[model samples]
Target: MNVFYEEAGTFKVGAILADNNTSLQIEAVHGKRSKIKASAVLFRFDTPPLAEFMGHVQKIAEELDPNFLWECCAQEIEFASDALATDYFGHTPNPVEAAATLLLLQNAPMYFYKKGHGRYKAAPPDALKAALAGQERKRLLAEQQARYVEQLNQFILPEEFKPSLSQLLYKPDKNSTEWKALEIVCTEKKLSAVKLMEKCGAIPSSHDYHFNQFIWEFFPEGTGFGELESQPAVENIVDLPHADAAAFSIDDASTTEIDDAFSVTPLSFGSFRIGIHIAAPALGIPPESALDQLAATRLSTVYLPGNKITMLPDGVITRFTLAEQAICPVVSLYLEVSDDYTVTGIESRIELIKITANLRHNELEQHFNDDALSKGHLQHALSKELTFLWNFACKLEKLRGKSNDTNNDKIDYSFEINDEHVSIIERRRGSPIDKVVSELMIYVNTEWGRQLTDAGITGIFRSQMNGKVKMSTSPAPHQGLGVSQYAWSSSPMRRYVDLINQRQLIALLRNEPPPYSRDSNNLLIAMRDFETAYGIYGEFQRSMERYWCLRWLLQEKIQTINAQVIKENLVKLDHIPLVTRVASLPEIAPGAYVKLRLSEIDLLERTFHAEFLQKQDS
Candidate 1:
């Protein structure tokens, strides 16, 4: 028996050209019989294209009734030659279907073939039936989703593209607060659910983001925000301190708030006198104001893929951080430093420094081998400055490091996927400008810190003790910079504790009693608070970002990715528990050129694909 399988609607046959003997669609009804029987693999092809013919049926004996085979037959078909089509054209009552027809003839007595004389029954495995059903469901869902997206792309708002009505069926009403409110109003309107939701006059309360501008529409004339809108702009303004700080940039997330300004002058004995600018956010915009309160809530800017949510409004934070750049009045910390970066003495002074622009902005880093900031200009400058501040900060960092030495490394590195090429890049090399700026800030911050302590001034102080942060390191003496009483007192734009610290320093310089007593608001407590705030700030941003990034990593196309064992008993993707060496860098493993396998990657579910590269010892 011969069963020829070819792509549906094709003029030429593929299986025959491959020298396959088992199946052939030919002009002859049968091939020459072989004396000996043997096994061979032939005539197997992928499923016939749904839109194309299955192939022509030539010289069939008879057709089956109930027409299951014919109805299920492919959309198209072809015969070996045009002449053969004429001989068998519509001869039988109904032509035999593709597969079953061939099978029926094969099982029949070839010398006396008659399709009506025999019946075919197929009992496929139970698993195959279930698998086919699942595949069908998936196809249907995908088709629906694609259709929804297509319809939505049309008639979107001229200015903004919005989801289609069909797409909204899949969107949950709970997504926004405005939506929640709309649900209530819609239900009360007594209209059909679809009609109520589609009404134009009132947008959903779920759109809290546009609430202030839109709230009026929801209320009757007397109940709306008419009075608030009519109030004079001057009346809405509150009593606040003047902020003349340089505008905040989105690029600097460093410790320096750059609230105030300073200029260093060399003094005797290798000591240099320093100046400090205290940022006064509470002055121009009181902490009680709407903008300030909101900024406090966000605590820091958030960076998420495709979008970002800033802690403070761009108009305020970007323009009102405060510094010498705008000639804002500030209490400055003056101090003398030795060659080793040691502060011999500190003094408090008042200053009107010129601020150039907002310096406290988002942090920018170059990817390995990618430089946009003048080739390590920033990194180099920062390094030199830190090196110069060695006298002051290096000592503090070592003490902290000594306390933190027992901690293990937190970061692991890699670059590869399933033998696909991805190269490893090196850390940044900073520029001279970076070093100078970094050193200047360190010097200024340390000087003021000592003057406040010496002047009996006290306020909230922050300490990241070496042994305190155990997951990464225990809070002990911080080794990042060396100092016995190393603490943060630099930036006030974002940090509440830093603000309080600056206030205390301001008091000392003004010869006024410090507003806070150390006994009441010590640095240790401030550290805890700072840590809490940092965690909260990071939670909304980095923590979620990591989850998404990991998800992307899992769905990457490379079959194998360079991986390193960073920990033991890491969880495998699919929530399937597995144990393996942590962060085992695959490329650096015992051998080279070994094949690897990607077990799984589920981005929607946020999981890592556990790969098995080298085989176990045989």
Candidate 2:
């Protein structure tokens, strides 16, 4: 006798070899033998062979429609498969027909649900319709994703992706169909998604990609000072006394936050009073004000190759910046120096100073360099003052016991962008123009740090020990700067830390209580947040500079380049601030120059491929 039975959720036909009361030894249709419980047997029949019976049931099951069967069944009721099969055929169903009916119901789980052995229940009409709709939606999405992949494989961007290009490039949802198609095509084509998209002309400008990614992460709301009401003009700003000396600032031509300026007044015999005036924004932006909160959150201005997001609003910066001919409110530091350039006395006060000129580094460096100073004459407007400050800066450097040897002799590259074209200008470190500005800023910062400590007030300081620089509320020596105590108070309009330090200094000078206490939570939090944000901003700037460097290479379109090996396989490209690794570098010593054949410049990934050519003999 052949028995059609369900075993472990699978239906099969087998021949009974040994009959027992509780169990039976049976051989399956393929002749394999097994023992099954009597309760597992659904029905037994004769005449038909086990294999033939199984084949007949499969054929019948294929002819059955699950939807038609579900519609025929009565809702809110359970019925046995054999009874349903008999009712459909208008007579008792054979073993094949009964098993075929069970198979159809089992395969269509969404249409019919199993209640027990040989029993079934039809799904509610509404639930079944919703499930069908979801399945259809998934099918349509699969079709769309296939189309996207097809287009991408042919190096064509689909029209649907244009709306979400930024999202697809920078931050993509992994579970999304667009990302899945992109991932598949990228792998198949052996290229990154960014490179593939660029090839399809989706990325109009690689520079925009880098910039927008930064803005998306750091300034999600966008880089605009929109609808924020500007604060009223600073009170008593013009009522302050106009100092006797005329001051001039030295900065890059593009600089807008003109923070620090200088003046030198000659005295009898060999004494002189040198004034270092800083733009005073802290007086206008009180702590916890709207502008103050904005600055605090940003911590510092975000600087890139050709653009910046100022920490303060444009109106506030213009009001406080020490522009030419403006009697600006300033925090002045006056130093009394002897003929030997030794600072005998120092004074700090709030005053008004007329900014006579805003010196551009491009113009000033030509006239105020070491060659010009040694000649003892410059025909420019600030020639005498510049010469005196250079001499005084040299003396100040000597007083710190810091030699020029500590200076890195490294090159500092500045980027200038106009009409999407980039020009990287190289400036030597430790130049006369750099020293004059750096030394005086250091002096003022050190003196103000000392003043804060003497007056028992708290200020944020930049300290270094064992070459590790950090920010802290407590005063510590900046070993690198060769200063006993260093507080950044020069660029209040640009840096939030400097703004806070300026407030403390102003309070100390006015004999008022300081805003941030020694162990204030706000002070510690600001230091922590500022350090993190500053590092992020610095990294972003370097990345953008690197991006522009790569663009410059492509713009110039010279395939052959020269690089000096810094170590092993890593080298710095000559004339540009780009460092990369050369896999083909053949075990060369550091500082050896090697010619390279450039290929495969990828701006999206900020990478390039280089092959080492013959080394050049110096």
Candidate 3:
């Protein structure tokens, strides 16, 4: 006898091999034997052949209309498949018709719900309508996905991707259709999403692509400071005492936020009173003010090759920056130095001072340099003052036990970008300009930190111990600077930590309670946030600098460059500040110069392939 039964939601025809009433052992048409429950059997009959049963049943099932069968079944409750087939066929149903009916009902889950073995109930009208609509929508979405994949594969960005280009590039939603299609194409082409998007003309400039990726994460609202409330007029602030000195600032040619400046006034007994004047933004911007909050959010100015995002607004910076020919309010640290450049007295005051000049490094270095100072003659108007300051700086360096530091021999590279072209200029560290500025800044910061400690005030400090640098509220020794304690009180216009420390110093000078107490959570939070943001900004700056270095290489277009091995396959290029690995480099010692053949420079990936040609004589 042939039996049609359902197993694991599939229908099959088999001949009964053994019967135990409750369970039957049967041999399928393919000669595979299985034990199935009798309840799973839809019907039993003597057929033309067991192997031919399913073929005939499937043909009949295909000929029947599922909708008609659903309508023919009872809607209110479950009914047996044989009963429905008998009602539809208008006669006593045979085994083939009953099995075909059962198969049709089982397949059309949207039209009928399976209740028991060979029994089903018709779905409600509303549910069937919703399911059909959802199925149609999925069908349409599949077609749309196919179209998107086709267009992307052909290097054509679909119109749907225009509005979401940044989102797709920076923070992709995996469930999104556009990203789904993009992921498919990227996998097939063996390229990153950014590279694939670039191929589809979605990314125009590789520089902007990398830059925007950072902006998306850090400055999600964009780099613009939108419609800040006007700051209080500088004249409306407290009237400070006018300083009797003509101060001048020394900075890069492109610096607009001039934070620190210097003045040298001859005192009695052949001594000079040197002033380190820092821009007093803390006087105008109070703690928890809008401008202060903005600065706190940014933490520090983000610097790149050709641009920067200032922590303060332009109006605030302009008012606070010690521009030449302007009388600006400042926090001055005066040092009474003897004829021998020994600091005999130290004093801190808040006063107004006229900025005599803003000396730029590009022009000032030509007149006030080590060579010119060594000869006892400088070509600038402040020649005498710069020479005296340089002598004092050397004294300070010697006192710190860093007089003959070898680190002075290191080279620092500065990037100059003009009309998208880059020029990398190398400047030696520990030059006259760098030494004088660095030494004075360090002295003032150390002095201010000491004062804050003596006055029982809490300030943010930068501490380096055991080769690790960190920010803390309490003062600690900076081993590298050879200072007892180091606080950042200069460059308030560029750094938020400097601004916070400046506020504390101002309070201490005025004999008022400090804004941040010993256990101030705001101070601790600011310290933590500033450290994280500063590190992120520094990394971004370095990445951009590296990008420009690569651009400079491509702009100059010279192959076969020289690089010095740092360790193993790692090498640092000669002209630019780029370090890469040469896979083909032979075993060599560090500091050995070698010629490299460069190829396959990829800006998107910020990488290149280098082949070691020959080792050069050291």
Candidate 4:
């Protein structure tokens, strides 16, 4: 006898090999033997051959309409399949008809829900309607996904992907239909999402692509001060004592956030009092204020070629920056030095000072440089002051045991971008302009850090012992700088850590309770967050600088370039701060100059391939 049964949610017909009351041993139509429970059996039949049984059952089931079967049944009521078949066929049904009806009911789960062995119930109208709608929606989405895949495969971006292009490129949502289709196409084509999008003309500018990728990760809200209320008036603060001498600031031509300046006043006995005046934004931007919070979020000014995101707003910078012909508030550190360049006295004060001039390095370096110093005269109006400061700076450098070392004379490169053209200028690291400004700033930071420590006030200090530099709350020696302790309190207008340390120093000078205590959680949290953000920002800046270096190469259209080998296969290109590997480079020693043939520059990927041409004489 042939028995129809349900096993593993599937229907099958088998010939019974042995009959048991609770279980049956049977041989399937395919001659495969199996064991099934007797309760799973729907019905039994004979006379029809087993091979033709399933084909006949499928044909009969196909001929029956599931909607018609559901309409024929009482709504929300269960009944045996054999009884339903009998009622539908208008007579006592045979085994074939009953099995076909059961198969149809089993297949259409949305139309009929199975309750028990050979028992079923028609779905409620509301549930059936919702289920049908969902199925139709799925069908439409599948069709749409197919279309998206077809277009992407043909290097065409779909209109649906236009709105989410940045997100799909930078930070993709894996479950999104667009991203799913992209994944399918990417796997099939073996191309990255960026490359595929670029092939489809989705990315217009490679520069913006790289720039926006960083912006998406770091500044998702865009680099803008959003809806900041009117800042507190800085000009109306408490009256500050004015300094007795005119001060001048030296910075790059493009600088607007002038943070530090200097004044050299001569006294009797050929002794001079040199003032290191730092812009005091901490006076107006009190701790936990709105402006302070804004500064804290940014941590530091993000600088790159042709652009920058300032830590403070333009209005705040303008109010506090030591611009020419303006009296700006400052935290001054004055040093009394003798004619022998020995520092005899040191004092700190909070006062206002008139900025007499804002000297640009490009213009100032032309006059106040080594050639002019050797001649004992400079052509600029601040010639005497520059001469004195240069001498004093040399003395200070010698005192710190940081004399000029020719072996470590590295070149500093500055980038200027105008109308899609790039000019990379190289400056010597230990030039007179650099040394004078750097030594004085270092001395003031060291001095203020020492004072903060002596007064027992909590401040952030930077130390380098064992050649590894780090930020900490306590004071330690910075062996690299040859200073006992160093704190970054000079550029409060540009760095959050400097601003934080400035607040502590200002409070220490005023003999008031410091803003941050030794165990302040805010101080610790700010220190950690600033260090992380500062490093990430520096990396982004270097990446952008590298991007522009590649741009400059293309702009000039030069094929052969010069590079100095740093080690085997790695070299630093001349005239730009770019280091890359040349796979074709012959085994060569470090510090040897070689000519390289550049090819296959990819801006989107920020990479280039260089082939070694010939070694040049050093």
| Top of the candidates by lDDT | 4
lDDT of 2 by residue, 1-618 (tens): 878888888988789899996888999877799999998888888856777887888899999988888988999899999888987778899777888898999888888889998899999999999888988999999999999999999999999998988789889888889999999999999998888999899888888888899888888888776654465535545557779999999999999999999999999888899999999998888788777777888899999999998888888888999999998899999999888888888899898999999999998888877777778777787787888898899898888876565454889999999998899999988788888999999999999999998888999999999999998878999988888899999999888999999989988877889989988876788889999999999999999998999999998996999999999999999999999999999999998999999988888889899899989886
Tens-digit lDDT string for candidate 3 (373-465): 778779999988898899999999999988989889989989899999899999999999999999999999999999998888999999999
TM-score for each model: 0.43, 0.92, 0.94, 0.91
Residues 1-618, candidate 1: write the lDDT tens digits.
Answer: 222332222212222222334433332123333221112221333344322223433333245322333333222342221112223244322222343344433433211122221222222335435655776777775665444333323311211114432223234446433334334445556543334443442224322212222122221232222333232211211332333322212123332334544445556776665455555544444433454444444344444333344444444444435532455545555556677656677655444445554433123233211343335433532333223332343344343343243222222222222332223222222222232344445545555555555665654433345545321111123334444343355556656555556656656655767655645533445445456657755554443344444534444455554333323424222221122332433433332222245545432223444545653331
Model 3 spans with C-alpha error above 4 angstroms: 60-76, 82-88, 91-93, 121-126, 229-236
lDDT of 4 by residue, 121-140 (tens): 99999999898899898899
Question: Rank by TM-score, descending?
Answer: 3, 2, 4, 1
lDDT, each prediction? 0.39, 0.89, 0.89, 0.92
**Clash-forming residue pairs, model 2:** none
Query: By TM-score, who's the top model here?
Result: 3
Local error of candidate 4 at 603, Å?
1.6
User: Over the full model, what C-alpha lDDT does candidate 2 score relative to the true structure?
Assistant: 0.89
